[model samples]
Structures are given as C-alpha cells and as structure tokens.
Target: MFFHLNLLSVFRGVLYSDNSQGQDGVDIYGPIDGGTAFSGIQCKNRKLNLIDGSPNRISNIDVQSEIEKAKKFKPALKKLIIATSLPKDKAIEEFVRLQSMEHVKVGLFTIQICFWEFFERKIPEFETVYNWYVKNEGFHRIKQLSVTFKDGSVEMTYHPKFQKTVDRYIIPPTNNTAPDINPYTSSLANLLQSDINKMMQPGYNSIFRSTLLLSNTIDWEQLCWLELLVSNIGQAVVEDYKIELSLEGFFEKAEPERGNVLFNPDFHNDIKGYRNSNSHLYIEPRKKILVQGDSFVTGSFYIQPAIAVEAEIKLNWKLLSRDFTDSGTLIVKIVPQYHVIINRHEVLDSTDVREEISYSLIKRKGTYNIGSIDYHDKESDYPVS
Candidate 1:
C-alpha cells in the first residue's frame, strides 16, 4: 500500500529522535495505526578534505545516489539541509551543480559551510565568495561586515537590496549599540580650535594683535625675519620673563636693542650692564689723558664697564687707524705731579681721586696692564704742593 506523509512532520520527527534517546528498538517499518507512513530515510554528513589526499571534485555518481536516496523520502522531505566543513568555493560549486539537475529547486537546498575552514589561507577567496553571497543569496547575505586592525577599524552595512537576504543568516543584533564615529569635518574644526588656543597665549596674542593692527605698515620680509628670530631667541622671554610670547614678540625684543649697532655680530647683549661699545667711539687727542697701552694693535677693541673708570680720560676710543702706526709708541703717558688748592687755608688734596680708564686700540693684544706707557718724561717738572 502506498502511503504519503508530511515532509515537515517526518523531518521534525527525525531531528527530535536524533536529539533524544529512543525508548524502543522495534522496527516499525510501516506507518502506525491511523498515522501516515513515510519512506524511511538516511541523512549522512559529508566531509570534504581539500588539503590532504582526497577527491578534489564531487562526482556525478555520488550526486545521483544522494538524489535517489532523497527521492525515496521525497514524500516526507520538504527541504534538504547539507552541512559540510568543505572550502567555501567547493561547497558553492557543488551546490550550484546540484541545483542545475532536474527536479532540484534552488530553495530546497540549504547549504552551510564553516567560515574558519573554508577561508583558511585564502582571504581573497573568502572575500569573493562573501561578495557573491551578498549579491546573489536568496535569503542569506551579509548584514554587517566589521573589519578591525591595529591602525583603525571600520564597519559597513550592506545595501538595501541585500538586507532581507542578510537578515536571514546574520547573527542577531546585540543589545550593545554601535560606536559613534567622529565626523570628518569635526577633525578640521578641532584643528582650528587648537590654532585659536595658540593665538590666545599672552605673547602670541600680543603678536597677533600687533600684526592685525599694523599689517599694512609692517614689511612682510621683516616680519618673517622677526618671526624666525622670535621663535629661536624668544624662548628666553618664557624662561626669564615668566611671559609666554610668540615668535614675533621674541624677535621684537631680541633684535639687537634698536638704534644700537652690532660691530661684533657674535656679541651677547643679554647680560646686565653689558654695553656694545663698538658704536661709542670718537677720535680725540690727549687732553691730560693716560692711555693704558697693549703690545700689539689691530682693528677695534672693547673695554668692559668695571675697568672704564680707572683710566683718567673719557673711556671711549677706537683705533680706526688700520695700520699699527702707534704700536710701541706712547699713546699717552701719566705725568707724576700733585696739585694743591687752599680752601680757607686748609690744603685740599686731589690725590684721593679714584680713576677708571679704558681704551680700544688694535686687536693684536688680548689684554693690557693699567700702567703700561710708551713714554715717560721725568725731566720736565710741573708745579707741586
């Protein structure tokens, strides 16, 4: 007697029986009383070994045998679920081949291939298959693809056409929300804010204000040079003055004190009381002057403050004479004489006067003494007390 059964009921019963322990071993081949009979069927797992020695292709014979076996159970089978650990490409090829056969509906074949095994050592292959399934899967497509790396991470959603298919196979959405990304334009805004912060600093503020107020009058090249100087030498303003200045303020303050000429470019003007004497000399003959002379002579000379007062005359002189015409010659000599003037019959002495003297002659001598003289005349006598 021919018997028919619902495919859903048979498949459900088989799955349930496989999950639970069967109580009886009785071989009840035909349908039970008042129940529809089903053609007993067998479902087996197919293992495909792509790496080691094994058949690389699925043969037609094997396909035919499975087809025949499936035909017997056709009355009770609504769908065929095939699970394999085969590579994705092989699994897809086999599924396609099977679907091409007569009486094979594409919807009836539900094939599952493990991603870990299928994509092993073949990332490009996996991507190709993933894209294909996303494009063509009837009810299976990528809902979301997340890619992460050490540098950055990205996640993308598939287009609407594939959303339905993707929803069928994708993992259920989690309770956790997706992370928020900073907008591309927001990055530029942040950079602008940083620049504003820099412009707000005291020194920078001064410079920016000055630049804006005097933009039309200031020379661009000079401003650029000033900017460079401020950047390098302006660090001192922050260090010593307890004021933060921009490169402009630094350069403005650092540039050789205005109206002061730098005869020596290598001179340091930061130290206290250190004057650039290169700009302070005038040629004058001795007016009762005592010159402390050095041995050799050269271009110009510099005398510091502490020694300037010891010399009798004004402490400003430069030997503009490039020729050493005055070397070993008497620049000036001190005449040893004392003068006394009586104030109300009390003699006032001038011997107690403190003297400081400095002279800049040729550069041949590194240093000179306080008493060196080119000429001393003891024969001539002047009035004394």
Candidate 2:
C-alpha cells in the first residue's frame, strides 16, 4: 500500500484502478513520464529481518503470476513494474526482460522496477513505514553475551586463575533456515570485523593489535619474536615466570650423545637454560612480552617431534614478586606439524634427471588432526587446550 497510494502523491495525475473483487496484482496505474499510455505496478511486502545475508525473496515464479494478471487489465499496460520491499535479484530481472518479447507496448523500454535497497534510499516516506513496522510488527532485541574471564589477576587481586562460562540466549540447537536463528555467531563475526577495521587505522592501540594476533596464533611458541600480550586485564605487575612445555621423549635429540642436545649452551644463555622445554618471561599490567623459546620459525629453538603426535602438553607457570606469589597451570595440546610433498619422485636405483611432474606422485597432504584436549581434576586449572 505504501508504494500503491503513497507514491502516487509524488507523480501528479497518477490513476489507480480497482476491480469488483479488488484483488488484481496491478495496484497503481498511471502515465510514467507524463506522456500518453499508462504504467502499472505490482506491490509486494516481503518479511525481511536482515539476517543470514537476507536474500531477496521474490523469484521468477512470483513475477510470472504478476505478469499474467497485468495482461488482464482493460487497457493494455505500457509498462509493468514490480516494486517490493526486497532487493532486486538476477532471476527476477531476467524474467522481467524476457516479458518484453510478449509484445507489450514499449514495455522493454518503459519497464521501471524499484528494487528495495534503491527504493528505500530514494523514498523518505519509508521512515514512517519502518516506524510503523517497529511499533506494530515488533522487532527482536538480540541478547548480548560476554563469556568473560574472572575480573582480576591471580592471588594479587582476586582469583588465582582465569575463569569463563559458556553463555548464549537460546539453550537448544537445530540445523535449518528458520526465523528463530541464533545471532551469536553473526554478532561475533561483526565484532571481529570491527576490531580488524580499528587495527587498520594509523597508530592503533597495542592491546587491540595483540588481541587480534593472540586469537589467531596457535601458541606463544608460534609467536617467538613478538610479545604474547598481557592485558593484565587487571591491575597487577606479573613478576618473572616461565612457561614449561613437556616435549622430552616426543622429540628426537639432534646430537644423540650430547647432554644438551636441543640448545648450544656456549652461545645462548636463554636458549641454554631452556633445554627442559622452558620459556622464560614476565607479564606486566596491560602490556606484552616475548618468552625465551617463542620463535617465528617452526622447529628452531623448541624441541621438534620426530613424527606427528597428539599429546597433551602442560603450560604451568609461577609468577613470584616481592609482594605476592601467583602460581597457575594452563594445559594445551602440542601436536607436531607434518609436511607432505605431492607428485614427487624420490626413491630409485636408476638416478635420472626428472623433467616434468606426473600423477604418479600422489602423496596426500596431512591435516591438523584431533589433538588431545586438556583434562584436569580441577576446573580452570588448565584454562586453555
């Protein structure tokens, strides 16, 4: 009705035709650019909640029915328009263009359809329509959720370890394209995009940049050179501490006879002391740090496993200061990365120069398997896995 009657005000001397039953698809009929013949419109109001990309609902079948109805009007329509509260779709556009071959007068040239996005942008009266929709039709208030860590540092301020909860609006779950869909995933995605956009700005906050990188990194070991940001998220200066990675039997010793097989004790003080899979570090209130063995290059300082293995590695740490002694444990799975080269010729008695690759070298690429998740006697003892 908004486009049927309300739009007629914008165009002078626009006529509206009504039948006895008053159920024809053509709602508004009038001269398009103030010439001779009449233009007809089929108004549609589709329920659009604007979630999951909110695809345009109108299809070719719906437009076909409208075209048939527009044919039955007393005087032939010079132009047919489909004005709806939905975006213009490719399927419907093609169908509209094909109808021109049906020999409707100047319809190929005069067909003027208003897509929902463009129409709403051009029409100021849509604000009133939307207001009415909010009042009468109502809207969903998406519940906000934050599974936050306990709001303090270990023994210094509050709890000794980080804690969180699984929070959501809906309790149950299902798999289907329904109206009552969960907005948690969509909301989180939007927040990530917002965070990324903020980071793109010049001289962004260090905390913001670290938070983005921390979420993506597999381990502190994966980010050796860079600081593993400590937002402190609390008001305490975390003293000297060490992250212990237990990779003794899993990794093959470089020098089988040597006592310190992993690190050359003479050269590196930090690397020499970390022979027992230890990474030395300290954390400050709202700052970042790089522990001893954290490395950008894989299998450099830390012990590299001989083969791929899924083992639960412990990251227990103790932060000791003059005022407070804070000790916590965070267990995580350490799985060896496997590199596979496909379509390669290796083993052979006849050594010859290979010219080109072939399908015979069909070695499959290894993927990250189901690494062991942390299992502990106490909750929050091992916060991450």
Candidate 3:
C-alpha cells in the first residue's frame, strides 16, 4: 500500500533495507530534494484479536520508541510517519500532534500517525491498492472460489444432446432391392472436433426419405455435473463457512450432483436445507473450516438446458466465512449434441449424384427434428418412390 504513494513526484519511495545498523524503526524511506533531506514511514500492525478477546493498542511508549529510533536514521529525516492498523485513538492523535510540535521546535523530524480510519478514507483515492490490499489481494485473510471439470479445467465443453436410434418398425421399408448405402463421409471431422473440445477443456444414425434420419435426446448429465474447487487462498483460517452457487443462462433445472455433504453437528445444520428453486446450489464443507492455503472440492451438479441448439451456463459463486468473505463467477460452455436430417427424393440412380443432392439439401434448407423422434434404425434397400 505504501508503494501507491510513489505516484507523487514529491517523493520516490524505496524499501529501507540498510538494516546492518538495525532498522532504526523506519520500514520505508524516500529522499526529498536530491537526498538533502529524507522522509520515512514505520508500519505497525495492531489488530484486536476477536477470537482471544485481546486488545491490541499503540501506547505512548510504543510511539516514543519508534520516534527515538527514527532520529538515528541517516540523511537527517525531515518527517516520520507511523502507519498502523490500530483503531483510531483521539488521545494518541493529540499526543502525536504535541510531540510533532516539540520535535519541530528542537529541529527534529515531525511525527504523525495514520490510523485505520486514515487508510479507510484514502481507499477511494487508491482503488487499486485498496482492492489488492483489502478486497481480494495481499497476504492477509481472504477467500477465493473457482470451478473446473473433473479434469481440473476451469472450462467444461460437452454435448448436451445424446443420440437415440429410432425404431425401424415405426417407418418400415417400402422396398428391398439394391443394398442401401451410407451417404455420410468422415474426413478428419473427429480430429477437428477433438481440437474444438480441447479449446475450452481439453456421433450418426439412419435414413427415412432416402436421405438420412437421426435423432438426439437432451442429455442433462452432459450439461451439468460440473466440478467446483473452493480455495482459501488467504493467510488465515476461516470457520463456519458456507458457499452459495447460483446458476444462470440456458438451463431449466439445477441440483447438486450428490455426495460430498459436509455436516456440522455443532451448528445443527446439514447441507440439505440450503437448496432453493432459483437454480442455486449450496454446500457447507466438512467441519466448516477452511484453512490458509487449503481448498475443498464440492460435489458436482447437473442442470438441464433447452433441448438442442447451443448452451452457455454460468456459475456465480459467493463464499461467506466467519472471518472472510468473497465472491466470483465461473463459466461453462456446452455444445448441445444434435443432427440434421435432410429429405431426399429419388432423382438420379447415380450414387454420386444422390449423395450430392443430399449434401446440397442439408446445406440449404434442412429440417430439424428435436426431442423424441420416430426414425427407422435401418435404411431401406431402395429409395421410396
């Protein structure tokens, strides 16, 4: 956070590393007027311990000791500022003001105190520092949530449609003459498709109108079943933590995929009651404890999107813990499995011409049959009429 102040041309800050003669109470220093004079800052962390009920305060002796040490700093300091996380103390502020006046009268560096309130007020002036230091960065207490697939990929790309071979009895063949030929050709299609699937992470059936008829059913298993990894990237332990995940976009229903249910007997609550109809999934991890650098994996979930077409599923997650809270969003893209069945009437007996006609028909105005379809599993030996 101190580095943020370097933006001003009045001072160019550098970390005070000349500790061979000891730190002299100055954590950071910068030269003013071509090193003719110097300004220094001392940082002290004094946060009240909520868990132990211990009060952390900065007393007069603490300030005086640092001030005396600052006097020993080289280059003849002009100002010494103490920055601390201690709560505001009007008495301490007044004491520092009087000290500053006395030191100034004696030709010593002036002293000042910047309490927690000062930093809080300056947050607006330094948003980047505020975010990195308080909101979501720094080495302090923080919580982060991320999601991925079983393969440990943040993105999951899969087909939401599953193929189902239609019953041949529904559309019986009208003739049994020349053997039927499969018109579909495979040419590096699977290779290209494999590459497409890896871009984020990492199918065919038979004839009705002498063309080719295939059907695909909506597959919820493919759309949902996403893996979530909740990490406590902070340097503190978090307790009584619960994660809420809301799913949005192109989905009909969503529910946790079962398993990994963490029960806190002392809290008298299980992960079951956290469900809601708003496509929200909730999980309270084991013992409700998330420690520094530790992470837990939540159970996968499943959601059903609209049958066919394409789908984009977004998972927005928020983490609430005893000492820390954070929120983030994750995206899951889905390529709904589908097929195009073109209608082809007998035109020419030539095999190549018939195949070209089918391809042209599909490329132009093809018919789409979604949901459960009545298609014959086997193609007739001959074209019908």
Backbone clash numbers for all candidates listed: 16, 3, 2
Candidate 3: Cα lDDT at 86:
70
Where model 1 places Cα greater than 4 Å from the true spot, the runs are 1-13, 16-57, 90-101, 104-385
The C-alpha stretches of model 2 lying farther than 4 A from their native spots are 10-20, 32-35, 49-56, 104-110, 125-385
Model 1: C-alpha RMSD to truth? Answer: 41.9
Write the residue-wise lDDT of candidate 2 on 1-385 in tens digits: 5445645543333545555666355777776556667778777776442222223377777877877777776577777777786666776677677676554464432345567676555544556655543443222212111111123212111111111122222322245544343222123355457767888899998875764644531221121111121222223332232222222223232111122424555432221232442343222222123222222211123332233344443333433322223345433344433222222233343344243422111121122224422211133223322
Estimate the TM-score of every prediction. Answer: 0.17, 0.32, 0.39
Error of 3 at 193 (Å): 35
Instruction: Please name the candidate that would achieve the greatest TM-score relative to the true structure.
Output: 3
The sequence of per-residue lDDT tens digits that candidate 1 reaches over residues 1-385 is 0001121232223432231444121111233224553323233223333222243444445444554444444344333333222334555556545554434454332222222242333323445444543444311321221111112212211111000000111232356765333121123245445656766776675755443333221110111111101111111111111111111101112122222234545543321221443323222222212112211111122222111112211221112111111111111111222222121111234453333322221111011223222111121211232
Q: What lDDT does the true structure give each of the candidates?
A: 0.26, 0.41, 0.58
Ranking of all predicted structures according to lDDT, beginning with the best and ending with the worst: 3, 2, 1
Model 3 C-alpha lDDT per residue in residues 154-268, reported as the tens digit of each score: 5676555432222111232458866343343222345345534544341221233223222222122334556566666656666766777777887678765443234433432
TM-score of 1: 0.17
